[model samples]
Target: MTKDTPPPPANTEQMNSPSFKLAVQDRDFLLSEPMRGVRFMLEYSKAQILLQRAKIRSTIVVFGSARFREGGPNKEPFWYEEARRFGRIASQLGGALCAEGGNHYHVIATGGGPGAMEAACRGAREVGAPAIGFNITLPHEQQPNPYTTPELTFNFHYFAMRKMHLAMRTKALVVFPGGFGTMDELFEILTLRQTGKVQSLPIVLFDEGYWREIVNFDALVKHGVIDSADLALFRFADRAETAWEALIEQGLDVSVGENDEDLARDM
Candidate 1:
């Protein structure tokens, strides 16, 4: 040996350097706050691709509490059963079973957690209809229910993206008794409708007494904050079939991809 040459280092600094890692494979780099916009886009694009491939032309989104159980406390069982029945009814009559031009309509969509979501997904599966479960990452650990179609089941990191997906294809909305999360979703749709951000969507709140007691739309009208005409934004229903009828009366077309609106907005 000439003894003039220095031995190579024990480790390859180039291989271990963050700069050497591919940007796509660098989790830390992707998750950094500076990359928030990229993360949002990633979440949006992934769900969009899957939904487009599934041919989910429109949806009858069901919102309710994950805490309400089949045989839980009083009225909770009724709410669960009603949500399940509503899911079945929507799938059966909303043209989800019959696709037109390869597009499915009125497919049941849920928050993809338990309680009413599980019940609704269960009902759709029983009818051999595909159901979408938009599960979210939560502090308490939310998991997708077994009843949602495996291919259609999706987990979302951003609530905004999840809500956008939920709103995008929705032809009608049916909300059962719920707590804070449920109210948030309900109010979100209401605000969109109020501001004309979305198409005129038929909204049905199950359990008329409960919804009336919880949210005083009448009070909002009385206070002059919202016009009395805004009261027509949503209707109260006491039964699953009633909700379906309200949706139909409000112009819920059971056809495929026929809405005058664009099927999916690029934004």
Candidate 2:
């Protein structure tokens, strides 16, 4: 290389990149003091709204398999109509309650991928209710569907953080037939509630037939593997109305909004 020519920059192989190291140190400094990197603007196309203190009345998170198609076993496709129905029902249930109440409205939120996520967002849009799609960039065949409300949609890099956000605002959970990802989300929430790490929230597994056949909760109870009382952790519903009724029976108001005070208390 000529004297004026520069050598290629050294590649740092350490797990924490130089930028990440600096970011962490900066964050630690801010935590101890304050106002350190306050001026550092994030390059994210959409900024995350940290509504930690915002009162959220009720949010329903719907989970299902992304690979399900539009028809059933008898047909050629599966999961398509099922996801659509799940979304449609959740939207109606949330919207009806919100309309009856006020701005403290119900919201339908999804994982922000296709399949059931799109169905949930589409259902909310169909009813003119606000919905949230929590998008995450994954290396696999996942992408945020176009049906999510632009203003309410959110993207995150951290699964734990995304899961935390889901738990933070969730009032209820509806689990549809899904794969490992769905189970991960579902069990995480269940463990949170079961361990009292988070507040008790309603969890409903839709499609009683499939759920019962796939996993036998009753057997768990019968075998004394788990306490029968623990079975009360979640409810099973065959349809949307049943799921809505289950939430209501728990003395939950779907249209409640969060106030500054409520948010502060939770935070």
Candidate 3:
């Protein structure tokens, strides 16, 4: 009835009490940590979801130089036929595996660039099998091959994430002649295998003649640059069929839990 009570505190429900203000401030601080944690978890969850949804019953990470060009409509690079050959073989193998039903070869994938990458994807398409192209963003180099299967093509911004996706359920790897990028992917897998981060997967280096001569790896072995055991790190092949067979023979259709022991050794 009087102004002495200050109009019943002007409906304090809309205002924060001193203790409530302190509690709110404390919550703001506390929420920051878990908010970051939640973000981390969400990113990880997204990666996991991508991995899970990939139709990777059997996979081969095909690596090759992006410089080579198929004889467009008429003019072609020197390596065009060879690259196409490799692609055809990989496709055939993938198709055969798919024909067997369960756990059969599901997809053939490439770095999703032109040249050799395109060849592999094209090969898979030719054989009527699903193929995936893992394209990356680069400055003025590489584009997703046209042959990539409509259902499986994916582009990635993070190379590490892309690499992880490449190896997620991959059964094998086939590496053709390439520059630094090819070796980068190759060594990445080797490092993963050496440290037991990933189960053993067959790695095929295309072209024995070119590989042996062009690479100084043999010199390293001869000069005691590396241990003999390291020589067993990879196999060499000159033909697409050979690489395909190596992949099939290895039978990496199952996943093994991370081997802490192997990781420890690498460390």
Candidate 4:
């Protein structure tokens, strides 16, 4: 319209700029409702690729309360120490710490928050084995503990996807004292085993006193809610050594070389 104005620059068009790119740079489009399925695939694919690359064939998932910090509550200290001990034991004897090259079986995995989760990751660290943390985004912004392997730590926005990753490669599940989240994961795996959705794996509930007092499995059988034989799906352990032995008895393959003392260092 103005005679004095020069022509627009050749590369100045908005569509040609990097900011207008839709595939990778458009965060708003990625978060849109229609993109929910894409988000789910992204969460699944990212974890799957990394795990395969790391040769993590199997995982030992640990579930517990995020509130159970060391020296914080009545049973917190014991639970924290025992969980840590079990981590070390499992990692060392379950072929995670083996020098020979092969699939890393029974590697420690956790919810990637504080408390017993931290203890489990810490246990894997003590044995110089990698641990995985499937951390979920929360209102309070839960973070992965320091002991989780830096390359293996994962963040998830969807609980369903996070739970899927937890169960997909799990060879065993060790439940310590926890509240709602722990119980949810425990029963979920048990249901999977019950329904034959997942092959049977060792499920151990640490601290027999706490679990027995909290959940009356016998009552469930007595009420005809669950069959009496269903109780055989899991076992109880009062200590770290006992928990490891129970896992072995339940068909966990332990390496022959490592001793209890060698695995229980810095305790």
Candidate 5:
């Protein structure tokens, strides 16, 4: 070897060494098939810890179409406004901001996307209550809306885990007119309730007309698929105030404040 070409440094021989790697820093290893269970546990524990630390006692899950926009197509504007109003009503009256030693209940929670989800989060923001957004990573990347509380927002990789978190702490559910994703969420909760897996809670569908047109709950009863008593599982409302009343009738424990005159007004 030429003297000008100095011998390679001995330390440079293992520059790509795996032995020096930090296990936590290895993204490839973490994403490998063997780590799937670990990933699931991480998803559950991370959100559990954050929510517990935030003192979120109970949640009102708002499930709806991400396609609806304010001032958009037929009934979209109405749906948007009603959903927003519901969020505010729930936050204001459901002990969310009551400060009972950080025991916040019935705080709004959403899918962390636009349309109805944004409206619900926006409503919670109107009352200055902390709202949660359980966002999922998608191929096109559904962005979380600005209304979600920054500290409470979470991103999830698995749909099952995300749904689990949504259902776990939910004290009630308000479902607006939506498509496939909305149906899936609605049914998930309904199934949980029907099977005695989840305790009964308020399930309010925002638009009665739209829901009747799309889903034939009556037909299910006629066909003997679901018992007539199952119809008692959900109720319908067209306005935000009416929805709030329905929730109260369904056994939601809401403390009425002296200055809570707005709850009496229909939106």
Candidate 6:
């Protein structure tokens, strides 16, 4: 091999092969079906790391319809404004606005889409508080709302992992009117509570009339599908402040700006 001839191009084909690409750098390899488990882990770990970095200790999850609008049909605007109010009130009183001891508590969390999610995040934004948006990729619902803190917003491909992240750190759950997806989430949480799968969570369903008309709790008890005592798993509220008061009465620890031993222990 002469120095001027460059050794016959040094067999560039081998180096350029797809298999020679680093595993982490190989998008096709990482996205393949065989790496699904790895993708799940990546989804889980990425959010976990970002949340930890933000010092978000707990969250108040708000689930509601993504279809509602400020001036659309029915009481859409009312519900939207109430959700916004709830977000603002909760952030102000629930320790989200205060990062005491390097930890933020009961920060607002939502599905990271339109309607109620947007309202809640907007409220947090209006109050200058950080909120979380756990967005899932879908053909109809990929764009995240504009209000969630950019650093704290996350995207996931797996619905199970998204649900896990939503459920894990929630201190309280406030659900507004929604369709099938929202119902699925609400029931799963109720089932988890019914089966003692998780710690006690304060659940408040907004709009008592709407929910009662939608799902007859009395009928369920009459049919013996669910125990009558199970009815106590969640309460109903018609207004935003009432919902906040209900959560407080239901044992949500609104003790803000405290680095108490109990809070630390829970952390």
Tell how far residue 51 is off in model 1, in angstroms. Answer: 0.8
Query: What TM-score quantifies how close candidate 5 is to the native fold?
Result: 0.90
What stretches of model 5 exceed 4 Å from their correct place?
A: 1-15, 255-267
lDDT of 5: 0.88
Clashes of 3: 2
Query: How well does each candidate superpose onto the true structure, as a TM-score?
Result: 0.92, 0.71, 0.68, 0.89, 0.90, 0.92
Candidate 4 C-alpha lDDT tens digits along 93-180? 8877756565677799999999999999999999899999999999989988999999999999999999999998777889999999
Candidate 3, poorest ten consecutive residues by summed lDDT: 254-263
- Candidate 1 Cα deviation (angstroms), residue 61: 0.5
Which candidate would rank higher by TM-score, 4 or 5? 5
Alpha carbon lDDT of each predicted model: 0.88, 0.66, 0.66, 0.87, 0.88, 0.90
Worst 10 residues of 4 by lDDT: 258-267
Rank list by TM-score: 6, 1, 5, 4, 2, 3
Per-residue lDDT of model 1, residues 114-221, tens digit only: 998999998998898999999999998998999999999989899999999898878789999899999999999999998998767999999989988988888988
User: Which lDDT tens digits does candidate 2 get at residues 87-160?
Assistant: 66666665423443354334677888877777767777776666677877687646777877776677776676
Off by over 4 Å in 3: 1-54, 72-79, 94-106, 223-225, 248-267
* Residue pair clashes in candidate 5: none
Of the candidates numbered 4 and 6, which has the greater TM-score value?
6
Candidate 4: pairs in clash: none
Count clashing pairs, candidate 5: 0
TM-score of 4: 0.89
- Please give the clash total of every predicted structure, in order: 0, 8, 2, 0, 0, 0
Which of candidates 2 and 5 is the stronger one according to TM-score? 5
In angstroms, give how far residue 39 of model 4 lies from its true place: 0.5
